[model samples]
Target: MPDNREARAAARTDMIMRTTLALAQETGYAKLSIEAVAARAGVGKHTIYRRWPSKGLLFLDSLLSLNEPALDYPDTGDVMADLRRQIYAAVDLLTGPQWGPLYQALVGEAQHDPAVAAGLGERFIRPQTDKTVARLRAAQEQGQVAPGFDLDLAMSILSGPLYFRFLISQEPLTRDYVDRVLDALFAGMGPRGPADAPASA
Candidate 1:
């Protein structure tokens, strides 16, 4: 009986999250509400409230549940290649129709709401940044990256431009742009040899 109860709870949670995403996709985040989610999910408002404290958090959880797998970093031993692959996959997901607008809405909300901003940093940004740093550490161990390089700074440098284009400049995030960023990053961060030494003036 206990096992059955747990299974039922899990199923209901899954259904509620999926319903939330579907409604957000159709009506957008600005129009999404707990009442709508509860009605569409066939659950009491209290049920969603018990699971999530706010609409922003509920939407954040739903977005991560659906899209986290696609954003995972690869470990192909070639750090640059792996980073390239993972970043391209991320760009595709972020710019795609399913979650892009929803994420944009969340980011907009985060600007005005401290709770949403904190949740975004803690739940999404920090985890992704940690994963990136881990990958860079692995490359450092393998001598692909400089021993003394700041992995955290490298992560920011790598992601900063993309976010700038994504959120600020509103420019297209193309593969060429990704390649250029990687090229520039690796040029400075990759293992250096005598040939890489700067020429005397």
Candidate 2:
């Protein structure tokens, strides 16, 4: 059990993270200021500075903390099904009510800041991609997926449509959209079988 002091510290951190997200949502990150976040969080400026060196770092932490740990992926011995579950989780993050705008802001920031770009790639994007890659490799080994399929390429193929929808198309992402993407990618790359049909026309 955490001591009272420790629990209070944890609560303060959570407050800060939530406040930062709300602030960013209301006014863009470009206009965010440490003084404002500290005032909103009800903490001193030094307290915020003690935890993160810059606003970008603080935003990164807030984004990364939103993820329910990666080990939450289910094995289920069916790699395609497992991948679908994971992809659905991604869809939830991209299109879900709380985190979607945060993701959008980070992507936009990454366009200008090389450091933010690198951090977002390493902290946010790659971990998610790596999970899919591992699932693909496991599926291949289990003989559920083609042995010759390229994991990186396959991951890209699986993700390309989702990113296109989320970033490029500027439309609301839906469960139906996710289903179509999974169906299309898996039909093309998954092992040939009677269970498979021509992907959604």
Top lDDT hit: 1
What is the per-residue lDDT of model 2 for residues 1-201, given as tens digits with 9 covering 90 to 100? 999999999999998888887898899778887889999988998999998778887887777785444534689998767877877777776787667877887888788877778888997678878877887788888887876888899888888888888998987777787778778877777787655556777
lDDT of 2 at 65: 80
Give every collision pair in model 2: none
| CA lDDT scores, all candidates in order | 0.89, 0.80
Task: Tell me the tens digit of each residue's lDDT in model 1 across 26-107.
Answer: 9888999999999998999999999899998888888877667456788999999999998998888788888678888889
List ranges where model 1 is wrong by over 4 Å.
Answer: 1-4, 198-201
lDDT of 1 at 167: 88
Q: All candidates' TM-scores?
A: 0.86, 0.79
Once superposed on the true structure, which residue ranges of model 2 sit more than 4 Å away at CA? 1-14, 44-47, 66-71, 192-201
